[model samples]
Target chain A: MKRLKKVGLIAVVCLSLVACQGGVPKEALELSPESLQQRQTQTRRFDTNNEAKLLTSGAQVLQDLGFTVEDSETKLGMIAASKDRDATETGQVVGAILLAILTKQAQAIDDKQKISVSLITRPISAKETLVRVTFQRVVWNTRGQVSKTEPLDDPKLYQDFFAKLSESVFLTANEI
Target chain B: MTNTVKKTACAALVVLLLAGCQTDSRDQVLATSESQVALRSIQSRVFDTTDKAKTQRTIIATLQDLGFVIDKADATLGTVSATKLNGYAMRMTVSVRDHGTKQTLVRASAQYNQTAIEDPLPYQQFFTALEKAMFLTAHDAD
Candidate 1:
């Protein structure tokens, strides 16, 4: 009976969450100053104008990162890839266990996460091509419910990805 | 068991009451307060250039600039789908086709989480951003 009440409470909380959500936020479609900064962070330019070559190298880098290609349009110079990885942390597990022991109820720990990436290449001119990549992730808890769905905006992540991509481009250019 | 059943029933009623019951949930599958033509006018625009490839690329760039991660894009079909996740998910699909010999039609439809975004103001904001990127005026597709 107590468990039933808990379920009801959870349902009510979820109902309130759904009810309170408004339409798309006002700034959702509008461009902001940070957009420029993010674009700079997510984009890099290569001296080679061969857009196809850049796309190929980008795919290779994603593969090296343990991501599986999901979609690509060579004509448009776009590639999408994703990887399913373990999201469990020892600290989170320990905390969950402690809370469960105190409350006599099991707490859901983070279990799995899927990180998705999109890569796009644009030609700036006859000699320059710009490659941009963005990443987002969906995390599920041990309960198999989505816990977090958000874009990954760590500048270092983008930097690391581009660094690998740059090396891949160089190696591919040299026929390595 | 009856006591538990009674409590469950009461809780379900509370859930319904808290939801406000503005619209019937069953009707959501095909429900639209706006007319089809009205929605079409709000979601579509015509550009003077017939360069579908360039227009699609510009749309991709605009979506990226608006903080969307591209999901899929098909040049042959002239469709690009992307999702923006900033605490919430906003999925948008932009399709480009020829309006005539000299004009290209670009239509974008977006859904915020589960609800379709039929609002005209948001669509206007989108076209404004897109036009700035394309360097072309967006003619209302009336």
Candidate 2:
């Protein structure tokens, strides 16, 4: 019983220390060697200097993808948008139900997520404009607590968006 | 041993009971343990450029390169804010202003998981990355 008490006391102190385990991660602001590769994945160049029109098309593409243009600055060639969507999957829901049945405890499944994106256009020169977009998301569980926060780094997602953006740029150019 | 156990139990109970009445919460708003001058020296850098727009764009590009999603940007104000979510949320803001006739001052501040980052190491690393993008050396600003 004395040993149990001592172990419990140590556990409490350890829990307190664990609660304080936050400092800025050393690599959080440091540029990793993959910086150039990540930049290439997030950026694309277009052969246009009509930056204002290009930004407009970028916003349109975001809207087409179910995002609300929360803010924009044509002078800076930037657009900020976000969308909230259901995050539940049938497989996870079924698994959660089975677990609840076995343990008689409620399991929190991912309830919803908000995806935010930033689209920026840099006019490298009069002939070339670099359009870069970055995406991140926050997922909340049914218990109303954050479950995940991550950046969207999928290359296919970027490729699809750029394909749509190219079509939007062409359509906007022709007033279609 | 019994006395010590009793004391520990009492202390744990007190902590559990007092968790809801944290006095630190009141001071969290606009609270910093570091002095203004010290934080200024840590977070600000100067570069030999007076073009505010280009400076802001470079900041944006650097932030994007670092896996941050640009949150907001203004050319006239020369400010950019970005957020990076990699299982944790970190938000950063960078501002540019003409420091003098021949130099521009850039300042950056960041918050990680809702806690302000006051350490100089992160700021130094950030400036190093910014230097790479700007192709100009970063000189600490007073």
Best by TM-score: 2
Worst 10 residues of 2 chain A by lDDT: A167-176
Candidate 1's C-alpha runs over 4 A off are A1-21, A171-176, B1-31
Candidate 2 per-residue lDDT over residues B1-142, each given as its tens digit: 6879877876776566446334578777777768989998899999999888888888988898888988788788888999999989999999999897999999999999967888899899999999989999999875
Clashes of each: 0, 0
lDDT of 2 at A40: 80
Residue A106's lDDT in candidate 2: 98
The per-residue C-alpha lDDT of model 2 at residue B73 equals: 85
TM-score (0 to 1) for chain B of model 2: 0.86
- List-wise, what DockQ does each model earn? 0.49, 0.56
lDDT of 1 by residue, A92-174 (tens): 99999999999999999999998888999988789888888999988899999988889899989988888788888883221
Error of 1 at A120 (Å): 0.2
Candidate 2 segments whose C-alpha is farther than 4 A from its true place: A1-21, A171-176, B1-24
Q: Model 2, A43-134: lDDT tens per residue? A: 78888888887898899889899999887778778999999999998999999999999999999999999999999988887877888889
Every model's TM-score: 0.85, 0.89
